[model samples]
Target: MDTREKILKAAAEMLAEDMGAKLSVRAVAARAGVSTGSLRFHFPTQRALQDSLLARIYEHLLPGDPIRDPALPPRERLLNCLRQVLALIGTNEDARTAWGATYRTFIEPEPTEQLRAAYLRHEREAERRVEHWLTVLAEEGALPPGDHTRNLRFLLTILNGLSVERALPTSQSVFLAEAETLNAAVDFVLSAGPASPVESTQP
Candidate 1:
């Protein structure tokens, strides 16, 4: 492999499995089996290397990565999709955590434009899915009719806050309980319509 590619790979590996040691240029070069000078020649600065790595990892964690299950009904599919997104916030070893550390990099006052745009796009896509499905069900009288756009934004805000907060020093129970509250909030919105008997088909 080329020297540039080798250095990038080594930096990524160091960042893997929740290790934060990947930011060191010397360490990264050693891991890549290249001289520190070689790594610096390519990256020039640590910020350049760190920013590039963060972009790659964010793509991996995008909401679109998880395709909806065809076996489930539309509502269930949407709920399951949201569940998967919320799952990103947890500290459980089983849950995805790379996004956590990468997010920390962007918390600085002046994150790069690329990073900011990527985050906004993900946030919008997430809100769109939740708002669209809820709006459809509400119009069909299957779900309680209410202001879905505002509600969807509120729910997503919960997710954003939790993901950022739990990424810091926190506990797993907080995530689980937060997920429960979110699930209940969704259910409550579903039940907001007039009390009328309707046959629901399981997806």
Candidate 2:
């Protein structure tokens, strides 16, 4: 693979496999089978390498691609989008660890600017995706009369919080039970919006 691809792969592996590992230039160089000079040539600093890795992770999580179920109605599409986004909140152990570390770095008062900025960007992208999906449903007249963006932020925050709780032992059961919230959220969204054909066609 090319140098850029090698760096990205090395970075991703390092991030996934060694979240606690201090990502030094030499460390990444060794991982990629490249020289420290070569790695530095591509990424001038450790923070730069991490920012690149975070960007790659963000792309993997949400590429901004259109919804996969093209034939579904706008309400279904919106709900599907919400489900997919919520599913990113570390459902499994590895994911839980990765996101936990990420959130730590984000909340730290002394993390490098690169890490903080990258996380802020990721959060913005997340909000935009949620807001965009909400807007789509609103335009289609599928949402109820509340402030969609604020309501979306409220719900997405709950999903993120639940993901964190699931990472801990005492709250795992609570998080599992909260699947009902996701179901209730869909019902609320649909009921608040314009009637679905499913609704209108019912005898």
Candidate 3:
């Protein structure tokens, strides 16, 4: 394999083995059997390397992301993408287990600097993914121009709430309520300003 590919492979493997392990230049270089200089030549900075690794993970998680499909209405495409994010959180026992693990690992005990950094890195990655979706819809003229950062935060806030709901007991089906909430959130953003006229596909 090529030098760059080898470095990425080594990095991915390291992460798979232990998601919390730091991907330091020296460590990745050693794992890849390449010189630090070579790894630097390919990645230049730690952020560059991490971003590439996360992009690979995201692509694997959502190959041919629905947000990019022109055949579907933009609203429907965005909903599909958001639903996929929730799917990763799972439901019922799966969601409860995830929450329990998170609390034990990061909350029950004093979190170390390394642990905090890992959590922040994950949060930033979520923000990045959400921003990418908003950008795509704006480009399609299906969404109005606005402060994308604010919009991203707003959307993620709703998602975080929905994820928590998945872990809790409820008398009614959360799926139907989740869809209504997602639709309302999408509508609010789409109506924030005058979007370039696009043909309506919504019933």
Candidate 4:
């Protein structure tokens, strides 16, 4: 494979391994059988490398293009978008571990400024993805007009809570399947913003 492809493949493998959380440029270079200089020559900076890896992971999880599918009902499209978000959070053990590590890094007693900035950038992209889908619904007259930013935050916040709950051990007192919970959450969020006139008047 080409040098850039090799580096990215090595990086993806690293993120799936136990050492994923402790990922560093040096470690990635060593694992890829390339010198640090070669790695930096391709990636230039740690943030760029991290972003590339994240983009790769996201693409694998949701291979569909972000463009809205006009053939599908708009709410179905929204649920599909939100389902992709859930997959990102609770797809597999490797992803769950990586997410837990990311959370730990950010919530440290005094997270480094660099870490905080990088995390914020990562989160902003996720929020933007949700907003983009919602914006499509709004434009198509499938969703009500409202504060896009606030609605984006609200949906993401609920998904975040669900992710955390999924990671925890189930209690005898309370149990909800992921499908049931997700469907209910999606319904509630859609309800908050009244359906567009076109949808409301439909059979």
RMSD per candidate (Å) reads 11.6, 9.6, 7.2, 7.7
lDDT of 2 by residue, 1-203 (tens): 99977987987887677444557788878989999899888899876787677667768886764444568876567556666665675456755775667756666546776666656655665676666666666766666544666556666776676666666666335644666766677677566653323345556
Give per-residue CA lDDT, model 3, range 1-203, as digits (tens). 99999998999999877656679999999999999999999999999999998898877876778898878998888889899999888999899987777776567767889888877887899998988899888887877665587678889999989998999977777998999999999888777733345579999
In model 1, the worst 10-residue window by lDDT is 62-71
| Higher-ranked by lDDT: 2 or 3 | 3
Model 4 scores a C-alpha lDDT of: 0.71
lDDT value, candidate 3, whole model: 0.86
The prediction achieving the highest lDDT against the true structure is: 3
- How high is the CA lDDT of each candidate model? 0.63, 0.67, 0.86, 0.71
TM-score against native, each model: 0.45, 0.55, 0.82, 0.64
Each prediction's number of clashing residue pairs:
2, 1, 0, 0
Off by over 4 Å in 1: 1-79, 88-99, 102-105, 109-115, 144-147, 191-203
Total backbone clashes of candidate 3, pairs 3 or more residues apart or in separate chains: 0
Best-to-worst lDDT order: 3, 4, 2, 1
* Angstrom error at residue 34, model 3: 2.8
The model with the greater lDDT, 3 or 4, is: 3
Model 4 Cα shift for residue 48 (angstroms): 5.5
Considering only N, C-alpha and C atoms within 3 Å, which residue pairs clash in candidate 2? 142-193
**Compared with the true structure, what per-residue lDDT tens digits does model 4 show for residues 1-203?**
98788888988887665322445789888888999999999999987887787788777888975438777876677767776776666644645675678666676437777666656766877887787777777787766766577668777887777676656655432234656766776677666764333445556
